[model samples]
Structure formats: C-alpha cells, structure tokens
Target: MKYYNKLLLLACLSGALGACADDEIAAFKTDKPESIVEYEYLNAYDALKTYVDRTANPHFKLGTGVTESDFLSKGLVYSLVCANYDEVTAGNAMKYSSVVGNNGSMNFSTVRDLVKVAKGAGITIYGHTLCWHSQQNNKYLNGIIADKVVESEHPSEPTLDPSVISNGDFEDGTITGWGGWGNSSSRAISAAGQGHNGGHALKITNPTVGSDHYFVQTSYNVAFKSGETYQLSFYVKGASTGTGQVVAQDANYAGDPFLDKSANKDFAITTDWKLVEMKATVTADRTLILLNTGKYEGDLYIDDISLCHVNTGGGGGIVTNEYAVQSDFENGLDNWGGWGNSSTREVVDGGGYNGTKGFKVVNPTATNSWSAQVAYDFASELVAGETYYLKLKIKGSVAGNIGAGFQKKSDYSGRGDFPAMSVTTGWKEILTSVTVSGENADRFLFNVGAYAGTLWMDDIEIYREVKGNTIPLTPEEKADTLTYALENWIKGMMEATEGYVKVWDVVNEPMSDWPDPTQLKSDPNHTDTENFYWQDYLGKDYARVAIKLARKYGGDNQVLFINDYGLEGSGNAKCKGLINMIAYWESDGVTRIDGIGTQMHVTYSLDPVKQQANEAAVISMLELLAHTGKLIKISELDMGIADVSGTNIKTIAVTLEQHKMMAEYYKFIVKKYFEIIPAAQRYGITHWSPADSPDNQNSFWRKGEPIGLWNLDYNRKPAYAGFAEGLSGK
Candidate 1:
C-alpha cells in the first residue's frame, strides 16, 4: 500500500490535490527520463512471458492489469499485454467493490462491461479473487448486517388478528371460557384423544333437543371491527354418523345475519377432523359472529378454531384479492432444495427484506449457468388459472440477473428462469408474476446469479397484493450466516464461469501483524471506511471455508489458491500463517487447494544484513510451500526504491549502479523460485507495475518507482534482461 496514509484521507476530504507531495508531482514529468545504463541482453531473447513458459517445467502464465483507463489507450500498454501476457486480471473490476454499490445493490456493469471487451480481443480473464477481506463493499455490508427495524403496515390503533388462534385447539381446558346454551352442560374440553397439535379438543356429548344438537361460547362476541372482512374457519368431528349445520352470523342467537343464508355451510361432523369456512363483511359495526349447531349429534369434537381478516376485497363480499404465501424462509430451508444441493442454499439472519432473517444463495456471474435456487411447496395452495405474485428481498456480491417460477415436483417440470429480477447490492424488493395452472405446482424456485459471487435473499414471500404485517428478521441471530455466506458465494462464482475462468485467489491477505491471535488483517488501511473483515466474524476457519467454497464451486479442475503479501519479511506472521492455512485446509478433510501465492512486493535496497535475511526468509517460505506439493506463484512482484516514509515521499532517481542491482534482484528471485521449489510445484510469476512510471498519484504501489520491465516510452528496461535470463535458467 504505497502513499497510503491518514493524511491522504484527510487531504481528499479537504479537497486537496491528492495526498501526494509536490516533489512526487515534479518527479512524474511528461518527458521520459533516460536510463543511464544500456543493457546487452535486453532484446536478444523472446519476451519474458514467452521465455518463462517455454523453458519451465510448468506451463506458467503471465498476468497483467487491464483496469487502468489507459490500459489500451496508449496502445503500447495494450499491445504489451496482448503480446506478452497469457492472461489479464483487472486490478479493480475483479474486486468486490467495483460491482456492489453503496446501498448493497450489485451492479456487475463494471465487470461485465470489461469482460466483454477482454473476451472480444481473445484475451483470457483470470479471476483475481473469489473471496477476500479487502476492497469489499463494507459500506453496503456494514449497513446490511447492522441493527435495523423492519417496517410493517400494521394498524396503528390496536387491533387483534392473533398470529395464532386463542387456544383454538383447546390445549388448556375446553370449558375454561367456553360455555354453551341448550344442553351445553354435557359439552367439555377433552384430552382423552389426540388434539390437533398435541392434545385437547372441545367435545360435545349426547344432546337432548334434536334441533339443538349443540350451541357454543361464553360471550357471543366476535373480536372484529367494521369496514373489515373476516374469514371464519374451524375443525369439527363426531362420534358416530352425525349431522349438523353451523351458522356464522351477527349473533346467530339473534340480530342481522352478516352472511347470506344460502351460503351457510352444512357438515357431517364425522369421527375425522373436517375444515369448514365462512366469509363475510362487517358492512356496518358488528358485535359477534355467532354459531348454532342445528339437528342431531352424539359425541362431537371441535378443534383449531380461527377467525381472521382476509385481504380486503372489492364490493359484493367476493374473496378475490387474496394470496396464499408460498414461503417466508423464516425457519430454515426445509423442503426447499430442487435446483441443486441444499447445502448451496441457507437461511441467514439480518439479510431479510425489512431487516429480517433471510437466505443466502450462490449467485454466479454468467447468466447461462446452473444457479443457486430453492423450492417451496405451494402446490396445494395455488389456484388454477390464477395470477400469483412472488416478492423477495435480495442482495448480492455483484450485480447479477435472476429469475423464478412455479414448477411441478413429481416430474420437475418448471418454466426455469422465467420470471426475471435484477439483483443489486442492497436488499431490494423484487417482484415476478407467475400464472399458476394449479396442477403439479410443487415449488416456487428463484434462480440466483447470472454473474459472480453469492446472492442473499430474505423475506421471500409469494402472495397476491394484500395489506398486512409480517415479522422481521435481524442479524445477531447466529454465526451460521457468515459461514454459509462463504459456502454459497464460492459455489455461485465457480458455477457461473467454470468454463472460462479456471484459476482464482480464494483467500487474499489472511494474516494480521496488529492482532494477538494474528488472524486476518481487518481493513489494513484504517482510512478506508468501507472495509469488511470476514475473519473478524468467522475467525480462524475463514480460510477453511474459502478453500471449501473454491473446491466445491470450481470443482476438481479449478486451480484454487490462497494468496497473501509480505512472505519475504523475516519471520513475518503473514507467511507463517499462510503455511499454517495450507496445512489446516488439507488436514481438515480438504482434498483440493491447488496453490499458494506469495505476493513479493520486495524492495531493491534492504541494506546488507536485512537483504540476506529477506532472501533466506523467502527461500525458506518457498521451500516449505514446495514441500507441501502445492503450486506456488509469485503473485504480485514489484521492486521499489526512493524510500516511501510515513508521508508520501519523492521518487528520486537512484544511481545507475543501483538500477542495475534492482534488475539483478529480479533475476535472483526468479532463479530461487525454480531452484528451491520443485518444477512440478511451480504455478507462475507476475509483475504488478507493468510500466516504469506511475500515471496516477494515488496508485496502489509507490508512484514513480521505475518498477516495470518496460520504461515510460515502452522500451525494454535492464530489468527485462534479468527477468528473461532468469526464465532461460542462465
């Protein structure tokens, strides 16, 4: 992290001309600085990219950036990449923040837009990473996992539509608040038989009056109001063959019958439970919804009584505008896996619509890939020839396309990816319409990801338009959310582009020097406000999950890897921690982790003992990784001079003697990589700063460090000779 400091942030906030100093500005002149030393071996061999793959035991790849605005604009940079590099990794677009927005909406336009360009040129795209702690959409995620209050359109003026009926099954006691008229003394709440849920049912024994078979209730008051519609549904049964007609009116004992007389439902009330329902409107103000059982009955039982307001309809008491919810995803995903494995989908907290617990699905980047989806049985609930509306709250690692539809369970017949929705960064309300033929409708499956990474879903509801209240889910529910997030995310990315992109840096920078446990470094640059640490919540096993996700998503052929920086430092915890991760991953039942990336951001001048110490430390680290039989890659190799102190420092030109020595270090590092690590275990090498000069004042590495193989004018530098020689094994 060059020129990265608190001062830089403060300067940007104060609207200063970047955090760089005036001297650095002067150092970066329009005119190219002439190199004092001329190299003899600069152009005698093939390009460094060709020479490395041509002579090595491994068919090594050369990767460079195509993220800079002028990557192909200067013509030289683009041609250099096209001619010399085997693969190009976008420095920023491949990162997470580039796609996810501030509101947690993922817009993969940045990624998709570039991938189109790269693919058109016949250049391959190396997925820089799948999961990492840096360059994350912290602004979106922090707010996503933050404490929130879900909004519900409940009646402000206290109303009663108990989510659950009041002792509907008579679990407590049947005659507690319930007393009937006309030979009601013989009736009582009985638990001698099985109840609806567990026990207790209202039993009406033998009755005397033939017409007064039974009458029920303490107060004939229906807990309802005017200007509202209510649906009364209940369960009833009889001992032997019994006959009865239950009436639900404005006090069936007397007063006006709110429901039509012809609509009165008749029942046999047999030995089995039967469901009967009546629909009516208050019209005017109301007091009670009375029920009278007419005719003969012996040993009758009633349980699970419910009186609730259904979705308000138009005039004429027609119950048309109602919806049967398919799933809320509140309780875990039980019968919700048909598209793929259930392990690929999970219910997580704090990601729901209206801030409730929801689910996270693997959403890949490609639109034509097998996506992460789950099933919800609504076959019995859906009405044929009726239009059903699906509503869900979703967020993703990147902006990807998605869809949903009602499908058959027996034959798995579904209009797959029919109802489309656009997934963004924030939890957004997406609506899709599915007209149900009401046949074999087994599940309402929503496909997530036609791009990259994981898609988070919450408050997944399929219901017709209705005004009501739903309970909200929140974060802090459990730790399963974080763990499952890693799982689904990896699978999503791998499944999306498994054909094109093969290699991925699974976990980036997972070691910290500041913390005691020395786990992952959280937001290394404290100045960047939108930084998220997966390790902070998931802890030590974060690496394990990353490897697992990569393996599961990318499959056996996927070149999965764990990458980190500062491996050359003397006994640095980052390097040791990386080695430890590899061991833990392999030993923890992991069979796939293809390689390890040592980001060699080395310096040209380490002053005597420190230089030797750096060399020994890197060689030891390489040897240790090689011993594991895992491939090793020099992920981001760059050499810098002109010390970058606490504040931004000027890039003063080093002596010609020092420049030659810098080139020598390049040769030495490459040579040591081949010599120490087994040829079969070599992945490849990469250069960070491809040009000798820095164009952006706020660039990632130290600006104007002359670290590239080519000079500002696109001429081969002395370092190219050293790199070429190292490749030739000279």
Candidate 2:
C-alpha cells in the first residue's frame, strides 16, 4: 500500500509539472518549502496554555490596539449570549441570554438578578438578540413589516353588536350560538385568527367578551401523560362578519389553559384564518383537549389538528422564520442632462417606472454644441410639506459643466431652461434638495450638453423623507457622520453638499521614496511636487476639519472624503501604506476617509490579463471598506493614450469596442453592487472626461489616438454610441 501511494503521488506530481512548462516548473520547485514538521496533539485546556506561553512575549498582541499580555492578565473574557425569554432556562446560562414574554406583562426580575451576578463577576453582557423568530410581540411585528396598504372602495360592515359578548360566558366551557367568525366585518376574526371585537380573540356582539363567539371542543381517544412531548395542530376559519381567536387547551382545567400547567403558542389571525400547528413539551397532562375560544358570537370551524409524542429522535428538524425584504430605491437615482447648440437628448430606458427606457444625450456639434431639454413626470406626486431628495447619473462630454434643477412649469418659458441649483463635471451623481410650494408638480425638466459637450444620464429618482416617531437627530446620530467619512467619498460629498463641506481630500497621490509616514506634507519648491495646491492650502486637518464642519451643518450628512489613487497592485504598496495613515486620522475623529478614489487609468498598452486582475483587486478592497456601510463611487475613469493608438480606422474600431466593453462592465458592477452591498452604501459612478476630446488627448485626440466618444470638434464618436447602447440595457 505504501509503494502504491508513492506511485500515485509521483503521477500526480508529474501531471502538475506538465501543466506548467519547464521554466515555470523549475521556478515552482525552487520556491517550494524544504522542511516539514509535525507537533504532538494537545487537549483544549493544554492547547490553550501552550498558546498563552508562546504568545506571552511583550511584543505579541492579540487584538487591535491592545497587546496579548494585556489580555492574558484580564483572564478569559466572557461573551454575552441571549435568547427569547420563552427559550431561556437553567439549560442555557449564557450571561447575555434574554427571556421574552408579554410586552407589558413580562417578568424580568429573575433574569435581572442573573445578569447582576454576572456583571459582579466581570462577565460581559449582551442580550440574546432583542428580536428573533419566536419571541417578537404583535406590536413589533406590525411595525417592522408595515407597508402602505391600499383600502378598498367599500369595507364590509358588521351586523352583530359587540356589546352582546361577555368573558363570563366562556369560563364554563359552554359553546355559544354566536354566528360571527369567518364573517365580513372588522368585528369578525381577520385572516390572522386574532379575536377582532376584543379580549385578544375575535369577539361577536361584544368585542371585549371571550364567550359570545362560537367555541369548539374536541376529545382525543388517547390518555394524557406527564413529562412527555406532543405536537398539536388545528385548522380554523372565521366568519367574514367578525374576528375571533382559536385556542387549544385542557377542557378539564379552569384557570388560564396555557398558564404554568400547559404550553401553547399564540398566532395572530386576520380575515383569512387558516390551519396552524404547534409542538409543545407536556409538562403535566390531562386528557388532551382543544378549544376555539373567542367572543365573536359566530360559528367557529375547526379542522385537521392532532397531538403526538415529542419524538425527540425524529427528523422534524427546527422551524425557521424568514425576514422581510428591503427596497431597492431607498437612496434614489439621479440622471442629469443639459441642452446645448446641436446637442440632442432622449430617454433610453425608463428603469421600470413607466416601463420605457432611461435617458441619454448625444453631442452633434463640431466645437461644443447643446441638446434639447428632456424630463420625466413622476407617477406619484411629492407631498408639499415634506422634504425630498433628487439624484441623477451624469457622464460628461469632454470637460464641461453638467447642471441639474427642479422647477415648476411656471419657472420655464415652455421652451427655455429652469434655474439650476447645483452642477458638476465628469461622470458623477449630483444630489440636491427640492422643496415644493403652493401646488404639487410631478414634471421635472433636464437639459444635457447645455454648452458644448456630450453627456448621458440615467436612473433618476426623487425620494421622500423616511417617516417615523424617532427623534430627528442626536449626538449618537451625529457621530455616525464620522463613521460615514471612513467609508465612501460620495457619501461625504453628499453630506457636505447638503450643508457645509466638512471633510476634504487635501492632497492625493504624493510622490515619495519608500513608504513615508508623512506623505501628506507640503513642499512648495519640491521639483517632483504633484498638485501642491491642496497640500499648501488645506493642512493635514483639511480633510478632517472639512468632515467636522460638514457634520456640524449637514445634519445627518456630515463626513468628508480624501480620495487618491495607486491602490491596485504590488507596485502600489506605498498607496496602501498611505491609506493606513488616513486610518490614523479616522481614529482621531479628524480627516476620515469617506472613500478611497482609485483613479482607474487603463493604458492601451496595459496587459489585458493584468488589467483584469487589478480591477478585481480594486473591487475587492472597495468591498472590504463597503462592509462598513459607507458610500463608494468610481471617482474618475479614463483610458490612457497607449490604450487607443493605431491606424485611424483600426484605432476608432478598437476604441469603440473598448468603450462598449467598459459600459457593459459598468452595468455588471452596478448590478453586483446592489446584490452584495446594502442600497444605503452605494454612491455613484462618474466618467472623468467627455467622450473623445482634448481633455482625454491620450485616447480622444493627439495624433492617431481616439479614446472617448466625441472628437475635438465635439462630434459623436463610436464610443458615445457604445455608451448609449449600454445605458439602454439598464
């Protein structure tokens, strides 16, 4: 057997070597480690001791900011554990465990005492999650999943008077002839099976009574046994006229059927009450009996429920609850356009709103032209007394201003432009606030290529403010601004635009030999100085103070971003080290990096394989930071000269194809982003320059090279057409 294993290993090694040529195989062999070592196994306790000894060196550290020695001195750190109160017991003694029950009627004295003892012993505390599958209250569930429910033209009325039912009538276990369950009235039990009239179950004549409604009782042939478990189930239908509750209990017992003596799970009922089953441990059993208890004074229909032994060894598995789905348009989509001479604008894909296509702008001028105005009329009207945010995607033509505005028909002369409150260049998402006054208007006009450039816009949205009874803003809320700053620049920018510019990237891409700690320092006369303006004007705190001030005035939009480049390859180690320095600023609550801008400058000569790998690495790093739930954006994107030079016709074809590929890549990225990152964390993507113009000389102009979608004369390039095609897909 040993000889056979050796032969098999040799064959496998040969196959691996064949996969790589001789040169590669030689390199691999040289790089392989020469030594192999094994250690004796140790039990958990002894293993831990050995770990402590080995890591006991003064310099060894276990956690961030603290050393291993410091932690060892503190002994074992107890992690808090918590669970629903109903699930809590001596069986589970974690310090953070929780016990949940009736909201106002819950008894926490016992658990509180347990927690006190834990705290006294230096154990950490964390409640099992405050909310979970089994323990959530009705009120909490309603609030969490509440959506705007549309009401019907006419609602069903109740025929039975609620005053007729009484709790006393239900105590004797006698069935009343009240005909209300499965009825068509609010007084009738809703589909959820809860008593509608009152008393937690659907009541008949009296919403408060537990007896006026019809009751059900069933006697099982099997005798009850103590200390055994059983699964019980039953089906119930309420009269559309009223609501009621279905309760299973021991008909022989008097006091609360599900009190300490029995175990039961309560389910809410609505207009369409259906069958539900539950399993419980039989603490003390009497002959198993089931009852449909409520005061609807209506007939209660029961079906298909049974009681069985606990069968602990069976394969029923555990019951799992599901979470509510989240919305995609929480933040909002903003697309911008400006009309200029010879510029044209049209809607591409409406993005499912009206089921049309979004909008796009085409440049037709030889030297900076404009397009006609195009806009959208939202289906839902904005509330006059509420605040709404407006956002749009913009890709600039060449290097020109891209403006956006919100206005009423009166603000424009039918054929002219409205006043713009905000504007920016390159590809970016511009966000601003719009307030409606006097009357509500649904139409918004957009003008792209307003001056002399080509630009495209898509994903427009005007979001209404979130509503709730929580406090407007507090210290803790303000502190979240700092958190946002360390995440994405787009977030910081939006927050800054809302009020004051707090955090700012004073200088990006400083030249340095090796990895210098103070790369942000300014040197006016330094020959290799790269864009010294930011460093000269904004001190190191420039980014930090910008964030601080923005938080002070931007309400919840505080944070600032100091973005830079060179974070995609091994050659960019300095950039990574620089990012660490930025982290230090974040720790001090100054100059937090709302985002790290990776100027994706893809040169034509760049190895396609390496380029793809670099892009992957960049995306991976961004995702890591995004987990913090900060905003992220592709700050600038442009192809290098070497990426687009060749024969004129060949160059144009290659450029157009590359441009199309880039657009498709953008769509893939956006879709993947929405899938992985929370909607709240995505900022926007922007192009660095207009299609093909002097600004992007490397790819656009400058001899045989053609990069962007427009030429020096502002004529549409093949690239522009490709971009338009891509946006159409979205």
Candidate 3:
C-alpha cells in the first residue's frame, strides 16, 4: 500500500526479493483523476506579453508592478518582467514618500539606477505619483507650517512685574491651560511637597528624543502685544541631566516662527532648582510660551513660572488693535458673500493662492467692474475721518484690475471705491489706507466683474492701525511659503526622471469616498507621521497645481494621469465621484488632464451571487470609463480568491477549482477592458501581482494570497493561459 511495497514488488519480479503479492501490484495501478487534466492546456501558451496584438493597438502597453531592487539587480525578477511586460512601474521607489526624507531632503539614487536599468533593457518607466495625502514626509511638511518659534534673548535678571500668564506658580494644584505635544509627552501637577520650592511643580515626562527639539513641548497661552518685550522666568530641572529651551510664538500659527537667539537658547537641566529667565519681544496680540525638551529624555519639573510685560518709559508703546474683519478660511467661510455677472464665488481648501483655504471667484466675461463682487458686512459702521488699513493678497488666471470699495448696506449709500489694482497670475499684496468720510459705510466689497477669469484672494484684513511693530507672518505669507515647498519638491522629482520618464500619475487618489464623494481627501489632524495631505494645506486645487507643474517640468510630450482605486465597486460611487472631481479640476479649461487610471485590485468571489455582481461591476466600470472618452488604464490589476464568507483564500488553502475560477475572473476583467474601452482610449493593463504572494502575515498587499498568474516557483499558472486568451480575444 505504501511506496516501499510497490518497489518490493518490482524488485521481486527482478529477483531482488523472496516473494511478492498480486494485491500489492494491483494497489499501484490506480487511475489518475480527470479534473486535473484540464489544467495541462495552460502549457500551450507562450510568454504573457506575446499574445498582445500590438499592430491593432500599438499604444497598448503591457505593464507590471516590480520591485526596484529586483529589476536593478538584473536577477530572476528582472528576466521575468522584461520577458513578459513592456513597461514597469516601481511599486514604491518612485513615490514621494520614498524619495523625500523627514528632514525635507530628497535622494534619487535608486530612481536613477532603476531608470538606467529599465532603459537599457528597452522597458519604459511610468512615474507612480506626484501628489497624494498618504505616504508623505509629514514631519518635514508639518514642521514647515508649525507654530512659529521666535526666540527672545535670555534675560539677565528676573522681572519684578506681575505675571501675565495664569497660574504660573502651580499653586492651584491644577494643570489647567497647560499642555504637552509630541514624543508622547504627558504633563501633571506634582505632589504638593514635590515642588522646587516646597510647593506643587508642573511635571512633564518625555519618553524619547524626537526629530526636532520642539517635538516635545509644554506650552501656556497668554495675550501679548507686538513690539512689547516680555520677561519669562521659571525654576526647573530634570530627573536626569538633559537640555531644554523656552521661546515665545504668536498665536496666529500659519507660518514659521522667527528665531532671535539659537545658540544661547538652550539650558542644561539637572536634579536641582535653577532659575531660567528670558526676554522676548511680542509680535501678535496673542502668544504661546513654550518650554521645549524634545531632544531630551526624562522627566522635567518646573515651579514658580513667571511671564511679565516689560513696561518701557516711552509713552508710545506698541498698540495692538484686533482686526475689524479677518477671514483666513482656515476654520471656514467667515460669512463672505458674492453673486453677479455670471460669476460664482466659494471658499475652497488648499485652493488658496498659496497652500491654505482662500476665496475663489470665477467670472464668465468682462463687464462692469462691479458686476461680480464679494462682500463682507461689518457689524458696526466705520467712524468718519478714521483711517482703516486694508490688506489682502490676490491673484488671477489672467491679468486684470479688480475694484475695492466700501458702502453702506441700508440704501447703498456712502459708496467709496479704492483705486483699481492690477492683478496678475502671481500673487500680489494690496495694502491701502482709506479714510472713512461717508455717513455710514458698513460693508467692504471686492468688485471683480471686469476680470474675465478666475481670481483667488487670501488673508483679508481690515483694521485701524494705531501703531507699527513687527507681527507674525499672516496666513497669506505662510501659504506662499508652503506653496514654494510643494513646487520645489515636484520640480526636483520631474528633473530626476526627465530623460526617460514621460508619463506620470500627476495626482494619485485625491478624492475621498466617505461623507462626500466629490470632495478631496484631507486629514486635518495629520496624526500619522507618514501621512501629509497636501490638500489640507494647499486647498482643492492641489491636483491642478501638480498637473501644471508636471507639464512645465516634464514638457508637452508627457502624458499625465489621475489615478485611484475602487473604481469598480458595486454602486459605481467612487467612479462617479472621480469623474465629477475631474470635471471640477478641469473647469479652468487650461489645466488639461491627459488620462484616468483605475486600479483594479480585484477579488474572485466564490459565492455565486457575489461573483455575478462583481462581474457586473467590472463591466459597469469599463463602460463608465469609456464614456469619458479619455485614455483609461488598468493601472494595478491583481486577483485573489475570496471564500464564501468573504475572507481571502490563502495560497495553500486554494484548491484547483478555486484557481480556475480566479483565472476565469482575470480573463473576464481583461476581456471586458478591451471590449468596453475603444482602441483610442485603451491605455493598457498592468499586473500588480505577477507571482503568488508568499505566506507572510505582515505583507502590505494581498498577504499570503494566490493573486498572481504564476506560482512563486516561476511556474506558469492557469491564470496565465486565461490572461493570454483574453489578450488574443479568444
């Protein structure tokens, strides 16, 4: 019955054994099952890419996702990919998160090597992404836009004036208005007798050193005035020898803070009470006092903290007046309204002239300067003969003049118009002083009916200036700075791949599927260090900006695409959402998007009803994509078998019949792609998983699943024949 018994029988017949039983011979003569014979036909096909009818669809490319290291090494993966695909997209090497570092530096050695290897082998390279919310260098991006850290000189002596910050002595035994950020830091009020001076002390515990010194921080909020020097004094020490610093920053945290003293800012902390005192000139009406120990490791104790406003003898001290009206749109639209002249106005995120939310106005045609206008109603009438300083940053799609005016809301009386200012494609600041003379002017308006293009306005401020002093950079300034960063990153990437890479996914997965289908994806908190949503800061026009930058740097011949996944879902919700978003992005009529990509990471459902529904969804997706008349690419194609319970079938758990089903599903996907999409719009189909996934639980993509056309051992699979049959239109 076993292998040894059959060998013994053969040996006995050949005189190597004493005896042999007829039953043992008969036991080895069982017939092979017929079901497995069906898979033998898979051996009949040639290499996967050979079945493509290139002459019929010359632009059609057979692509595969590959690891950069495997291809660069010219190993087995290199041989297989080159023999079976026409183009290669590096799975991760070409992404923004791969090249950009936490310190905002970029390294392209891997990309350059990959390009050289692929070019030498006659394989085209496709750029993976230019902009996306996930997989970004969040640390660097956030640091650039973090609450500014303006350093003030260390005070030689402690101030005798009353403290401006509340509960500076920690005598109340509460950590109210005191908090910590970064490095998983926590704060509390120490035991009553644990204070540095026999009273409760503010206790801060930092777990580890962070990338930046400010990453571990303790902060308190207090009102401050521009140009007014403030003295901050505290007694503190750490459980162990460590270092820390203290600084003052404006409450308006749109831009980076100025540093007055970097070398002398740091102080060594030991297990002893030491007096720490510093002086800083305030900038904004509100300020945050920060105690930074991000680079240190251990617990910190502080007591008797004091911050006092330094009173100068001069009668003309800095006077801080709150703006009568301010709308950064960081929170939301601050009740701004506009309607006229076939023009529309709305507040959009990441749609700012720089990298923040801003007011956008689009005019159909040039008419009266006042035909299209945006207005903000002031609660109180402007005092007669009082000078109000109005400042705003504006830009336009085309050069034109926009009129600014003040008017009374009651009878449209007291209309006073400022001089018309010319606006160009680049952002320009308009600062003017207007003396109110009308009996009552209760509203301010931006008249843009004469501008026959899209206009963007950010950081609008109207206030009476009582005194001049240095203030924190406004929202517009911060947005502009961040815009430069985004542009520089894109430019660098384009230059690195300019030689052989002509096609790019300029924006990847820009739209969100939940809450609102047509809206762009954004993470306001940005808690994940690996995710930095450019849209959160740059606004809704992020994709347009990416496309424009790619075109400028990559040249006119380059093909750009917007790519996303889940387009083939049942309701076609994501597909419809993406289509609408694309329409909105192209509304300008100049930011041309060349194509769309649908990542078909599909599953072959074992349930009968579910399989039928999946098939219908795939067809629907292809039809919808074809209707757009744009080049449609099957960007990432892979297949896995799903059990009746919707759990993914592991590679070892998959049976021959299940493999056959996945093979047929693959055929259906490829066949419908060609049948539904016109030849002109058929960009190509790419295999995301070329080989069966390994039995690794920690794999990021389709872990331990049989999703490939080939087995892990490089053997052709049933799916290979099915894919070939689909390509040949069988």
Best by TM-score: 3
Model 2 segments more than 4 A misplaced: 1-542, 549-556, 569-575, 590-593, 604-606, 641-677, 695-707, 710-730
lDDT of each: 0.61, 0.38, 0.77
- Cα lDDT for residue 320, model 3? 49
* Residue 613 displacement (Å), model 2: 3.0
Give the per-residue lDDT of model 2 (tens digit) for 155-252.
32211101111221121122222232322322332222242221123233333335432343323333446665555544455454343333223445
Off by over 4 Å in 1: 1-41, 53-56, 68-74, 113-123, 150-498, 515-518, 522-528, 642-652, 693-698
> Candidate 3's error at 571, in angstroms?
1.3
**Candidate 3 lDDT, tens digit per residue, 1-730?**
0111222234446542323637675455433346435555665677778888998889999999987887888988888888888999998888877888888889988988888899899999889988877777767776777655434343223223346554665654577678868878999989877886576789888888776678987888766677677777788887777778776766555212323244366776878888776767655565677788898887788887767666452222234454778878887778888779878878898888578998888999999987788888987777777767677888888766777878888887655666456575667666655677677889998888888999888998888744423334565666677788778887887778756998888899877878775677777755556677777767788788888888887787879899999889888888988998898989998888889999988989989999999999989989988999899999999988888999988989888877878878888889998899999998898898778888776477888988788788766677887798889888
* Candidate 2 vs 3: which has more TM-score: 3
Question: Each model's TM-score?
Answer: 0.48, 0.26, 0.55
Deviation from native of the Cα of residue 426 in model 3, angstroms? 51
Compose the digit string of candidate 1's lDDT tens values, residues 1-730: 1111233344345444433557766455332124322443354556566666455564677677555455535365666777777777777766767655676455555555555656666767767777787788776656545533435343333222321233454543444445556654356767645555445677766554354433533233455556666666777776666555543335434333324335645555666787766566655556655455535545667776666665542222212235445456677774666454322666777666676766767643455434456567763545556556666667777644566777776777753334345554555565555567656565676655344577777665566543333222232332366566556555555544535777888777777756532455765323446567776666567776676667666666878778888877777566777777667767867556788888888776536665677678878878777777888888888776533331322334565566677778888888888888887877777787677656476666566667777666566666777777777678
- Lowest lDDT 10-mer window, candidate 3? 1-10
Summed over model 1, clashes come to: 19
Per-residue lDDT, model 2, residue 108, is 45
Q: How many backbone clashes does candidate 2 have?
A: 116
Q: Which one wins on lDDT? A: 3
Model 2, position 617, has a per-residue lDDT of 61
